[model samples]
Target: MSDTVEGPFFHGTKADLQVGDLLTAGFRSNYRPEIVMNHVYFTALRDGAGLAAELAPGDAAPRVYVVEPTGAFEDDPNVTDRKFPGNPTRSYRSREPLRVVGEVLDWTRLTPEALQGWRDRLAALRAEDRDEIIN
Candidate 1:
């Protein structure tokens, strides 16, 4: 049987972020939290023709998009405008799921405390599963 493999986790909170959180020089990639941010957004410079096909030909709001918190964002000051340089994906809206934002830490470089926290959650889930089986 295959062993149940847990995973590396993230360590951060809203307190860890700010409205204009800028990435430091040390932050090199979107794969690491210290490298970039967990939350950010980007918009398409031009309306995608694919999305426009669905609508009747007329003047209306363009279907611009923003990337969801797919993973930690890459810090790129060059991507000016509404887009946050931290994430490769663009976010169209302001709100996003916390789970998606948690990918700030690199899987290859997880923090000790973050791993512990993940273990705790996994243990709880396992316990819950056991309780369901016996009851």
Candidate 2:
């Protein structure tokens, strides 16, 4: 993978955040709460972040925020070459904090049916023990 990526990065979550909030690593994995995350994840694709937001576990509404990495980041190892070749998802992670620069209000939201479909897929993966999260 390349050594650098440019952004206009974004993070998706259900956490309520403000303009100056700093997102950091060492949080629990959204996909697997038993495992703590080592990196703060973000993406260059708005829709990708939106998908993460939708899947994020919470009763609070999903939100996507514009972010700036405070330190070096790299292609997410979980999906970079394992799932698709060469970071087509534009996904990344950082050990350092990511500053919330702004919020993205106009990102596409998934339809209820679409959301259910994704949930079903996740459930199936879990049932089959195929939902391995590399955290």
TM-score of each: 0.22, 0.90
Q: How many clashes does the backbone of model 1 have?
A: 10
List the pairs of residues colliding in candidate 2.
Answer: none
lDDT of each: 0.32, 0.90
For residues 1-135, write the lDDT of model 1, one tens digit per residue: 002211221222222333334322232222222234333333322222112211212334222222223333432243434455543432222223322222232213235575457556656866886799799
Residue lDDT tens for model 2, 1-135: 224577889999999999999999898988767779999999999989999999999999999999998888889988887897788999998899999999999999999999999989877867666435443
Candidate 2: misplaced stretches above 4 Å?
A: 1-3, 130-135
Candidate 1 wrong stretches, greater than 4 Å: 1-108
Backbone clash pairs for candidate 1 read 27-35, 66-90, 66-91, 66-92, 67-90, 67-91, 73-86, 73-87, 74-86, 74-87
lDDT accuracy of residue 118 in candidate 2: 94
lDDT of 1 at 47: 28
